[model samples]
Structure formats: C-alpha cells, structure tokens
Target: MALLLLAQIASGDSGRVELIAHPEVGAQLLTRDTTRAIFAMRQRTWPDGQAVRVFVLANEHEDHVRFVKERLAVYPHQLQLAWDRVVFSGTGQAPTRVTSPTEMRERVATTPGSLGYLATEHLDERVQVITME
Candidate 1:
C-alpha cells in the first residue's frame, strides 16, 4: 500500500505540481514541513513578518490535492468543514482557488505575500520552487 501510494505520488499526471514563490522570497516559504505548517495554519506569518498568502488549485486535478491531503493525513471533507467553520467564525479565509497551474504560478509570482503551486514544466526563473521536506 505504501509503495502504491508512493507510485501514485511519483507518477506525472497533469505534471509535477510544485510549491512556488517569487525569486526574492527566501527559503522560509519553501519545504514540505513548511507547506504542511501553512496549510494546517501553524505558521501564519513569513519570517519577514509579512502575512502569508495561500493559493490552491480549484479542484483535485493532477492528484496534487490528494498528495497533500494524504501526505498530511488531512481528509478532504474535513478540510472543507474546517474552512466553512473558519468562514462562519470570521477567523481566517480559505485559500484563493485558481483555474489552472499557470494562473496559480502567475498570481503567486506577481502578488506579494503569495504562495502557490504549479506544474514543474511551467516553472520559470521568475518563480522559485519550494522543496518538499
């Protein structure tokens, strides 16, 4: 089961969806643990004290969402439920969902405090790939 799951994660679906940030941004925003921390709402601010902005793909395409969810043992419905609760409680906002990986990358690269994911093939010098721990 572990091997199968690993294979699923390694297989290229829509392509490799990677966490990305602007070049000027440091490694503080990159890493599997950090990604998990952000998604889990542990680390709310960047090392520089800027509010962290999060971006998510609109759906479960390319298995990226599943990767994160399973890797973190985060259930999809639970995540949605948490988001709904946060929304109603007026706590924090859910991630801004984008239509495509390109859109995610573009938005994250251009917007300050933004962090997002994209296919590895689409990554360029303008964006820095965040490493998974």
Candidate 2:
C-alpha cells in the first residue's frame, strides 16, 4: 500500500503547476520544505523576513488537490486538517482562497508577500516563478 501510494505520488496527474510569487518577493528559489512550511502557515516569513501571505484555491479545486499532493507530498485532507487545527487553536489563520486560477493570478500579483501555485500556462509577468531548490 505504501509503495502504491508512493508510485501514485511520483506520477502526479497530467497538469503542471508552478510556485508563483508576487514580483516583489525577490525570491528566485525555495527548498521543498520551505515551500511546504509557507503553505502550511507554519512559516510566516520569507528568508528575507517579509511577512508571507499565502493564497490557495478552494479545497475541492482540482489544482489545489494536485499541487498539495504532488508538490507537498500530502493529501488535501491532511492540509485541511492542519489548517483547521491552527485556526481553531487560534495560533494561525487559513490562507486566502480564490475560486479560480485567474483569481489566483490576480490576487498573488496584486498582493504583496504573496505565494501560491498556478498551472504553468496561467503564469504571467505579473508574478515570478519560484524554483524548488
């Protein structure tokens, strides 16, 4: 079962997503752990110490599920549970949720200190891609 899960994860679905940040973020690369931390709301600042603002598609969104599983190596349910625990315990807040990829691009582009994932084709000059280090 574990190997099967690993294989499935190793072969994520057809779509490709990119980690995108506001142009002002000034970060060209981030380690997988750091990227996960930011998305998990566990790390609140970038290496440069700017506050990190996280964005996400709705929990049920296909891209959200794919990115969480493929990039973060976890199921969407796990991420949701973590967010719920933090929110209920009053230690952190849930990420801003956008309904569509278009909204995601707009929000991440206009919001400072923002980070989110988008299908590669949705990426544009308004935001820069953060390569996994």
Candidate 3:
C-alpha cells in the first residue's frame, strides 16, 4: 500500500485524495464502476438497498478535479454535464456541495450513508474510508 501511494505521488497524482463515507455507512468496499455511477448520481442506493447521499466540492476545485479525473476517470466538465442533465430533466439531484475540505469532512462525518472525497491529512476517526477496487 505504501509503495502504491508512493508511485501515485511520483506520477503527479496527489494521492492524498481519498473516498470517505459516514461512519454509519454500511459499505466498506466498492468497485470503481459502482463508485463512478454513484458520483454521477446514476445510482441512488447502495448495493444493499440503503439510500445514498453523495457530497462534493465545487467542480473547479483542484481536489474535485483531481478526484473526478484520477478516481472516477471522468473530466470535471463531463461530470457537470451529467449532473445538469439529470437536474434539468428532473431525474435526479446533484450531490450536495460543500464550500471547503473542512466542510466536506464535517458533512461526511455527520450525514449517514453519505460519501465524499477528502485529503488524507483531514481524515479522522469520525468518518470511515471506503476503499475502491
């Protein structure tokens, strides 16, 4: 794990970005595709049928851009378009946006079934890390 993190850093991937979830969230592991779908707001519930609450930072934020690109394998613009389409078409709602990483951490920690990304340095026992495959 240390080697992989080092490699990501060496490759200019600010690997500090991590997928975090509310402590009460049931999921501990998820496939990359499922994670993308959740972030894209296509999957409204977890595999176990629990409702999902997705949170995000502003699209143009560096961590947001990096998390979209490096983790979800999508561009920030594309993710925005997806959210816009759903919201405009009245199908789904966009993820709640937090103003800063501090708010992201706070919201994710307090909201059940919530998921968001944050830098590792901001992590605390209040939230759980959701590992992606």
Candidate 4:
C-alpha cells in the first residue's frame, strides 16, 4: 500500500518531493487536506494525537518550492502568508525552518512526531515516507 501510493506521487516528475515523517508518527496515510493543514500549522497533531512538529526548508529552496507547489498544491508565498498570520496573531507557531535537505532529513528523523519532505534521492530508512490521500 505504501509503495503504491509513493509511486503514484513520485510518478510524473523526476524532481518530486515526498513526505518523510518520524517513525513513531503512527500514520501510514493522511488526507491531502490534513497534510496541508499540518504544514500550515493549522493542524497540531497527527491522527493518533501525537503533537506534530513540521519542518520546512527556506522559502527559496527548490525542494521546498516543489513540495509546496506539487504536494500541498499551494504557492510558496501562500504558505508563508498563512504562517505569518499564525505567528503574527500569536495563535500558533511557525514550522521549524531548516537550511537544507540534509538538515530537513536529520531533524525529521531525530525528532519525534516530526514531518518534513525530501527529494526521493535523499530518503533513507531513518525516516518513514508517508503517503498523502
């Protein structure tokens, strides 16, 4: 099931981005809406109720741009605006901003309840790939 979903997401583009979550996040599949909400910092927990820790690359990073545009189906600035509102309003916190893909993978792998994205080539067993519905 996981492999099928992964192939479907990774099928079209050579430069695709995929979700990499902490091994303990406890969800094999998440609705696209839920994933978006999480990245937007609107949703604070996983389906099983673990506090979510979202990680993202700088706005200008290519993989970050692709993940927002392709997987989340939102523009980079749109996501940034949502985050700005949350932080500016003091309602919630922004997702952790990592400097590079290696940092993204490292943080997500070591942080429990964390979620992040990486190019297919950077993925390894340290983290689990989650499929978006």
Candidate 5:
C-alpha cells in the first residue's frame, strides 16, 4: 500500500517537478554518507562555490518531522541539541523553518545551492526534488 502511494506521488507529474542536485549530489539521502553530507554544511556549496541554503518544513507537521527524524535515526530532541551546539559554536545554522511545503519549495528554488524535501503531492514546476535512495 505504501509503495503504491509513493509511486503515485513520484509519477504524478514529471514535467511539473524534477529532482535536482548539485553535480556531486548523490542518489540517496538516507545513507550514512549522504546524511552526513546533507547535515554537515559541507555539501552546501555548489560546483561553483556558491553557498547552499537549506529550508525545512516546520515542526507543526508531525509526519514530515517524523520522516526526517526516522530516516536519519535521530530524534527531534537530539536534532535540537545538535543544532544548538552548532549554532553556539558558530559552525553552522539549522535549516530555515517554513510553515508549509509550498513555502519550502519556493525558498529552495529561489535560493542558490539550496536543497530540501517536499511532499510529492506539493511538487510543482517551480521547484525540483532530489532523489534519495
């Protein structure tokens, strides 16, 4: 049932949406290396040395937050702690939180070297989705 739903979502409108990536962006986001890259702020730069911005769905949506947490095997609380540590240390900033998927997609598309995830249902021509293995 879940597989069917994902397929429906993934194939809904290929023309309206596309998965995007930096030239070096890999296929899967859940792997240890990919996850590390996505979170470490190292992968934020593009092939041109542009800074990458990350936009994330706000925590009000339980399912979305759970998806990221579970896929990365890190609880929300743990993520918060890590964010705080990074912020305090002046190393990196936590993802910019937005109220809706629409907002997330907009911000990601406009911001150079930006990357983020949105519901397949919410995807449209304006933005791109990067595949995750």
Candidate 6:
C-alpha cells in the first residue's frame, strides 16, 4: 500500500504541494514515511536529530487539504484526529497554524527545524524545499 501510494505520487503531479523546511534543517531529502511522521506529530526531530517544528495552514484551507492528501497521502480529517489524539494524550502537540501561504513560509523560515508545505508560487528562498527520497 505504501509503495502504491508512493508510485502514485511519483507518477502524478505531487508538485502542487511542495514540502519545505527551515534552512537550519540541513537535510534536503526525506522519505515519505518520515515526512508523514513529522506532520503527524509522531517525529520530534529531523534526520540529523535537530528538533522538528511543524507549521501548517488551517484545517479547512485548500492548500492544507492538498498538502495532506497529495504530499502525506492522508485525509485532512484523519490527520486532524491524529493530532488531536496526540495532543490530548499529552504525547505530542499540534502544529502551529498559519492563515496563509505567506505566513506559512515566514513562520517555517524563521522557526528552526520547521517543516511545512506551500504552493509553488508562494515559495521563496527563505526556506529550502526538500525532495522526497
């Protein structure tokens, strides 16, 4: 199932949502599982062991939906539930929510070890785009 999903992303236009990270993250690549874990609040650090911080757009936002579905291959409701469970269980915290892509970019760029997704046009050199490995 994971292989199928990765194939789908590889064969299709997963470019609509681009995974981005703070420049301080250092690593320029991540596997789908790692990316999913980070966004799902299950991973607390990058591959290099730097603390991971996640930023996101609102749950109902279109970009958020696309990023969750295309990039993470998970439905937004499912992701939200996962976050809620972790937060309520005292095992994790929810991602920082931003109102727009500009804010998303800004927050991710400024916050060390931050990771997020953005539409191509909204992206800038403030953050680094990590390739799916």
Best by lDDT: 4
Q: TM-score order of candidates, best first?
A: 4, 3, 2, 6, 1, 5
Say which prediction, candidate 4 or candidate 6, comes out ahead on TM-score.
4
Score residue 89 of candidate 6 by CA lDDT. 100
- lDDT: which is higher, 1 or 4? 4
TM-score of each: 0.73, 0.87, 0.88, 0.90, 0.67, 0.87
> lDDT of candidate 2?
0.85
Q: Best candidate, TM-score-wise?
A: 4
* Worst window of 10 by summed lDDT in candidate 3: 1-10
RMSD score of candidate 3 (Å)? 3.4
Model 4 ranges with Cα > 4 A deviation: 1-14
Every model's Cα RMSD, please?
Answer: 6.3, 7.6, 3.4, 2.9, 5.9, 6.3
Candidate 5 minimal-lDDT segment of 10 residues: 14-23
lDDT of 2 by residue, 40-132 (tens): 889999888999999999989988998898888888988898889889999999899998999999999999999999876576678887888
Model 5 steric clash pairs: 19-129, 28-133
lDDT of 6 at 114: 91
Q: What are the per-residue Cα lDDT tens digits for candidate 6 across 1-133? A: 2353355467774447789899878888889888999889999997788999999999999899988998788999999998999999999899989999999999998999899998766667788888886
User: Which regions of candidate 1 fall more than 4 Å away from where they truly are?
Assistant: 1-14, 28-31, 70-73
List model 4 lDDT by residue over 49-86, tens digit each: 78999999999999999999999999999999999999
The number of residue pairs in model 4 that clash at the backbone is 0
Model 6 spans > 4 angstroms off? 1-15
Tens-digit lDDT string for candidate 5 (1-133): 2453367668773223233333333332344446545554445554455676766665556645654565555665665676677788998888778787677767766766676665556665555445545
**Whole-model Cα lDDT per candidate?**
0.65, 0.85, 0.88, 0.89, 0.57, 0.85
lDDT (Cα, 0-100) at 132 in candidate 4: 87
Q: Residue 55 deviation, candidate 2, in Å?
A: 0.5
